[model samples]
Structure formats: C-alpha cells, structure tokens
Target chain A: MKEGNFCCHKTTERSEKEYKSLMNRLSRIEGQIRGIKGMVERNVYCTDILIQVAAVNAALNSFNKELLAEHIRNCVVRDIREGKDETIEELVVILQKLMK
Target chain B: MKEGNFCCHKTTERSEKEYKSLMNRLSRIEGQIRGIKGMVERNVYCTDILIQVAAVNAALNSFNKELLAEHIRNCVVRDIREGKDETIEELVVILQKLMK
Candidate 1:
C-alpha cells in the first residue's frame, strides 16, 4: 500500500495488462468529469447537470462493483483457501459498509 | 487497480513509511479477526461472538474513515485544484453511499 494508492495487495505478474485497461477507462471517465465541470462553469441548466451527475454516479458505481468483484475473487477467496476464516469476518465487515 | 489492489493514485515519494505503519495496524486487526473465527468454530456463546463482531465492525470502520480522509486530502483536493469540479460530484455520490 502506498499513500495515494489504497490497494493492499501486491500487484500480480499477470494483472499488468488488466490494470492498464482499467486505468484507460478511468482516464476516459476523468475526461468526462472535466466536461461536467465545464458544463457547470457555463451555467448549464441544473436539470442537465443533474442528469450528467447521475450518469457519473452510475459509471463510478459500475467501476466500484467491478473492482469489488476482483477483490473477492482474489483476496477473499485466497484467505478462505488458506484456512483464514477470520478474514471472512473482515470481508463481512466490508460488505456491511458497502451495503450501507 | 492491480487485481486486488484498489488504490487509484500513484504512490508519492513520501508515503512509504505511513503505508508500512497502516499495514502493521491492519495485520494486528487481521489477527484479532482470526480469534473471532476460532470462537465461532468452538461454538462459543453467541453473545460473545456478537460482541467481538461489533468490535471488529468498529475497528474496520475507523480504518476506513482514516483511509477516506487520506483519499479526500490527496485525490479529491488535487482534482479540485486542477479545476475538476466534477470530481466533487463523484465524491458526493461516494459520500452518499457511505452514509447509507
């Protein structure tokens, strides 16, 4: 884990390509974000802004869901395999938070 | 993101030490988590298990709050300074989810 990096697991040898693809998606999303800011600065209609806001929200939630899927497949499953049942509790706690 | 790593930002040159410290705390919490699982496997009192579960929840929440604070200070603030108001909407959406 690095200061700005919230990832707890070390990068796997095979995930570099996937990581790059995810970053590309995030970059495009980042640009769309800038477009929204421009719209706000131009005094765009509140309803229009709100619509864009909703789109962004959906996009972000999708991204988070994908990341969470990966986390469960990789981290949580590995813990279970290693007989680390306690990690299940950690995951349950995380799930509870996410559900909230 | 690298498979299991959820961090979106590149590590700064300065946060290595802080990251290590955070990981150490996480390791301790992880051990406590295993203890909870052992209690469960032993068919310990349900009330005792629930108490431990609550403690784990609080501990995890505190950890997440600290991480979120760091994220806001680093990622959100940087986006704002770079004229990215749309990032505010992203954060607002995230906060709404967290509050839920």
Candidate 2:
C-alpha cells in the first residue's frame, strides 16, 4: 500500500515523513494480521500461528515506539515550548495508563 | 463522518457494525485532535485546550476499550477454542504491556 494514506484519514500531529512512515508500518501490520487470520482459518500448525502472532505483537510494539517518539517531539515538545505545561500532565496521564 | 471508511481503508477483523463504530469513533477523535491543534495554534486559553485534550484522551480510551473487547471476544476466543493456546500468551503479553 502507498504511504501517507492515513494523512487524509487522521490528525496532522506528525510531520509528513513521520506520517508516511507510520501509515506504512500500520499497513504492513494490518496485512500481517490478515495473514494470521488466514493461517488460523486454514488450520495451520498451532506453533506456527503462535510464532506469527508473536511477530505481530513485536510489530505493534515497534509502531507504538515510533508513535510515542513523534508525539513527544511534535506535540509534547511544542506544547512545552509554548508554555502549555498542561501537556505535561496529559502526557503523564497517558504514560501512567500505558505503564499500567 | 460516515462510518466504515476504515473497513475499506484497512484490514477487516471487525463485523460491519463494529467496523463502523470503530471507524466513526476514530474519525471523531481525529477531528477532536485537529480541533485541539487549532486551539493551540490560536493561543486559546491553556485550561480550555487542556480540557479538550483531556476529552481526546477519553475518546482514545473508549476506543481502546472497545477494540480490546472485540479482540478478546473474537481473536482470543477463536484461537483458544481452536486449541491455539499460544494466543493466550499473546494476550497476556499485550495486557502486561498495557498495564505497564
């Protein structure tokens, strides 16, 4: 799939490059998930399907890391620079939720 | 915004209704984030922007909850019933990460 499709589909919190990368990764993950579903439906070996599932989990984590980096650099940093310390508190809340 | 746009735009793990609901909620959240960005750019009152940001956060949480419910009901259950115990481990790992 082409990158940046989500640019029209989501908010503009990331740079075009970041946005493209994110959409690209998400697209691949989406495909990976579909593939896993096919494996399940086709009665692939349990261990093999499990391994694919693990890979999907890893892919999701990598996506999260990229998103967090973009959020910090673009949203959090900008808000702090503009004297919106409230963004810090918001970030703190999300971090708590994520770490929970 | 019309619902189910993402059904075409992404992989389909959801029923039509679920896909619609999820897509609708996400589109609204996308718009909400954009609105918050506008507030930020215009130097809206800090507290007000923060409030909207909080709303966005809540929306996101709602989305997550719905998606998680669907995952447990659909993916996890199906996998387990099919004798794929490994899906349980995958769920445990994600829950741990989310709770972290």
Which one wins on lDDT? 2
lDDT, each prediction: 0.53, 0.58
Tens digits of per-residue lDDT, candidate 1, B1-100, equal: 2212365533322166645544454455555556654553454433344455456445545545654666578767887999988878877876666554
Candidate 2 off by > 4 Å = A1-100, B1-12
**Candidate 1, residue A22: CA error in Å?**
34
- For model 2 chain A, the run of ten residues with the poorest summed lDDT: A1-10
Off by over 4 Å in 1: A1-100, B1-14
Worst 10 residues of 1 chain A by lDDT: A40-49
Q: Fill in the DockQ of model 2.
A: 0.05
Q: Count the backbone clashes (under 3 Å) in each candidate.
A: 4, 4
